[model samples]
Target: MRLLCLDLEVEDKGGFFAYPSDFVELDCSHKPINQISTIVGSSNGLLCLTHRYRNDSQYQYLYVLWNPSIHKAIFLPVPDFRLNSNRHYALSHGFGYDPTTDDYKLVRVVYVDGTVPPQVEMYTLRSGGWGYLTASGPANVIADWTLSVFMNGVVHWLAQTPNGEGNIRNVIVVFDIGHEEFDEMPVPKSLEGMEHLNMEVAVFHGLLALVPCNGNEWELEGEESYSIWVMREYEVVESWTKRFDIDVGVGLRRVVGFTKNGEVLVIKGGKLLSYEPSSQEIFNPHIRSRTESFYFSTYVESLVLLNVEDGE
Candidate 1:
């Protein structure tokens, strides 16, 4: 697995993250230079990043599709809507590769007035521009920090449905990039009727899963519990199963992703750790990162984009 982190300085420079046992300052010489950006998602060795700026107090946003393994990138042209008088900036984005078209695409939804439905847009790599999509969008709030998980040419995010005046029920919002369509799927039944729960979509064994945060169990004492519900069959709610219940001597806040050998990696109190369920041994991967300064996610290194350039 790989990770991305910011350089200690303000300049947008840092190295590729490789987890080591000892806690040491990671080196940055190997990473490509970048702007301070939030990672919207990553797939097929491609990373989607968005950087927001203010020029004379006017909002400016830039989107980039980068291949860290290739150390190359392509800057996306601004969507037409954002350039209009309305300035319909995107509130969330999803990225995926469409095998059917042999292309990469981005899906974003812009927030307008609360009463106004979100304006959806689709960005195709070959097209190099964003076009409006009329696909169904979230009915209620979508957590801003929920980075989408791309799998099987689909992007998924944790979303919600309004239950009452101010309450909501959790659900998963799916976007089929190849088809340019949107759909909603039921979350694990265990998560149903949960108003105070927080969750995120994660890729588990190449399938979609929900990482439900057991925040109440997280503390300095007692055995803490962590759970993930894996969808054995895509788009089938009945197939959702609790694949694992991790009991750790220490507390953990999140299960971001998994490692190559199936070790579950988690973050708690700002440190990255790995738990081998078979051995029940937790070890520090020491993925040196300064949380306050950088955005990060796990990835697998590849030379895909370079091959694309070579073919071109």
Candidate 2:
């Protein structure tokens, strides 16, 4: 299996400020045919990527690439789409290859100039055309910028709803791919104070898992606080159970991905921690380096680890 980490630098005025780099390329048996941007592991051990390039205006394009074997990467151009200067914007969110359909899909949450409605554009790899997915919620629910998580052939994202007076409620929006329908998923009871924490969602072991960071409290005390909630069954909004709660004294972070053996790998401060849900045992790899981003695959492969120094 092969894994890769990408370091992205965003420029500011006099100097450059470093943000968290995007995680790309998961562990897989298939070797990439060429160096392609936005590589992601598709279901059934396939490597999917797009030839993405940035223009002077900062827009991006998606060109599909595949490596049937380890030696070469094949670039496939969709019929209707052109690689010209079309102001195409590329997003890593909500883009993955679905094994069931054997098609790559690209979903982006964007805003149009004349409309107040938030729009979701979907592009299928096989058809090479764009379709609009209907969305339901307040105008501001979809974040102007946020990542989209795909689970069970559906895409999920966090949105906001304006309550009475001036308050707002954070809700989960789900889009079903098969039916092309939109629905809402109830957040876990434990997600009460989600606005105050850094949270993310992923599918683990045929279940949905939520990870939340402890924020300034953990930063000041040098402690880590995180929890993992697993969905007991599919499509049952409230069927979630807390699997594990991690409290590593000051300097540890939660694992962002799973190991080939199904162990949940977390990082604390600068160390790696693994938790096996079946055994409820936590193991430390003791790697004394800070990791910026991580991705996992179903097999063991050399992981693309990243380390960054303070920018000047």
Candidate 3:
């Protein structure tokens, strides 16, 4: 329950540059910094980053907690779980702060060979170690590349679980940070069988929101609109409501999360676009990338990890 002061800004120059107020581009020319695997999640201004590198014949990954404002970082120790070279695995991560314990926690779920009940582990800042969770995870495989939203001390993921008829369906997997419990919530009834399309759980205007598009941008030949669904009340399945529809038209690649002012950040072709719901207009901040690759996360500047030492 660590309260975050949203929209606070700071000036600092480094590998990551904030653009149009939200997106940041990594400067790969920086050594060691280039190893950032993914910008997993953020809480209280501390970023959870995974660094992957090749050690001799094996690959190794280290989790880093960093506060760009203070230029301080702490590298977490390797988890007790060992990689099985014979099998392939996919990793999903969630980060948040538990105000009850006054600790920051990182949750990692490893799916070995696309199997269910994935191996789950957590790293607590105060404990300074990683511990394995014994609970049985959701039977569904959490969607790769889908976004996870942290709200009200819980992290929600969009996953597709198989139904009784062997057909895949979408479900919201919930993980409570303080209790370290796993649970499942049903998605809006309209999106039940549409798991094939791109969908994500996002926070809109202080409520848990869902954004689902009709088709992938590359596959759509015509215009398409995305539906914004928000839960009027937390944990109340019946409270889910379709707030509005955003018509992004053609070449809308992805919905890149939202801005503090409630504008929708999206990707179109090779540029970043912001759509304002009230005005029903789209504005380009003139941000472009040669590769058309963008990673979006709401960043805040603080001194959360300023006291942590390396390798602690």
Candidate 4:
């Protein structure tokens, strides 16, 4: 369980998927998505990276805690916060596991100055930590692609209003690692207006899902027809259910979560499809040849990543 992709070009027959015939690939060729800039969440199997650069001009921020199933990586430690400008941004990032202090946390949403009013941090890898929630972040939503969706133990995102400045309305930004609270979850009010629509925040079955992808109409061999919405009641936000309508001829390219038999794990073009909406079939969990990125996230292979200090 682990699917990641970004900006492409890391081909080389990488691996993941402990269940659909079990694949493994992780020899570490500078792999943290090769110095990623975004993948910020995934619990139980750890994976929360953020590596923005530009040093000579501020904007540093580095953090990683990967665990590609024992390829074990930990590289975290650079958060005394002091960016001031490079625009000082980052609107979402969360990694979970707080089973009442078994620790392993990482929540973020900084905005030194993207539009002001957004700073909330927490690191705590068993107390070799960093913390500053100071009463939880509230900067009128967040933009630049907010992400973070670790179910039950809490950690969810999808809120935008800051740089868009006005009434954006569509909240769901929780974070409750054993009472370190900061809640607001309720998004399926018959949802719509997906900014451009392709929404994500997944983890179905283990609850807390929402996989919107309405891209209907496209027959030119480019296949297009979508409807992936799910939220069969994680305490009901009207139970937003529509799970998989996929005419997906190709190009959803990213829905990387699901398949505990619920199957809907996608990543078109770069291969790795498994969408089986009750026989709408699209098999091939063999993870086709040297695949590339379309962005991914789905993990579960822990040893607590062996406790930090491996690749800083």
| Number of the top-ranking candidate, with TM-score as the measure | 3
TM-score of each: 0.77, 0.60, 0.82, 0.31
Considering every candidate listed, which one attains the maximal lDDT?
Answer: 3
- Model 3 per-residue lDDT tens digits across residues 267-298: 67666678998888999876654111344565
Residue-level lDDT of model 4, residues 1-312, one tens digit each, is 444432323432234445455645555566545423556666677766676666786656678776666776677767666665436565567778888778778877776556556777788887766778767575456444535677778877766455565545666777787787786766666553334444546666667766643223322221112565667767577777766566557455456666556677665655767777887778775464222233455545677767566544
Candidate 2 regions with alpha-carbon error over 4 angstroms: 1-41, 47-92, 96-102, 111-116, 134-148, 162-166, 213-225, 251-254, 259-262, 268-272, 275-292, 299-312
TM-score-superior candidate, 1 or 3: 3
Candidate 2 lDDT over residue span 1-312, tens digit each = 443222111111011111122332323223222332443334333334443455674555454433322322334433232324444332334555556676656555544432334556666656656666655422435543334567788777655553242554555667666555667776676563344434556666757766653333345221112666667886675787777766544554545566557566666765556777677687765343333323333422221111211111
lDDT of 3: 0.69
Q: To one decimal, what is the Cα RMSD in angstroms of model 4 from the true structure?
A: 17.1
Off by over 4 Å in 3: 1-31, 53-60, 162-165, 213-225, 290-300
Name the TM-score of candidate 2: 0.60
**Whole-model Cα lDDT per candidate?**
0.65, 0.48, 0.69, 0.61
Tell me the TM-score of model 3.
0.82
Query: Considering lDDT, where higher is better, how would the candidates rank from best to worst?
Result: 3, 1, 4, 2
Hey, what RMSD does candidate 1 come out at? 5.1
Residue 134 in candidate 1, Cα distance off native in Å: 3.2
lDDT of 1 by residue, 1-312 (tens): 555433233345544445433223433333323444666777667777676667664666677776766677666777776544455333778888888877888887766643225678888876667788866666655565556788887888887764344656777877888778877789877676576655678888778888744335445222212566889998889999888766555546667567668787776656666788778888875553433223445667766456443111
Which of candidates 1 and 4 is the stronger one according to TM-score?
1
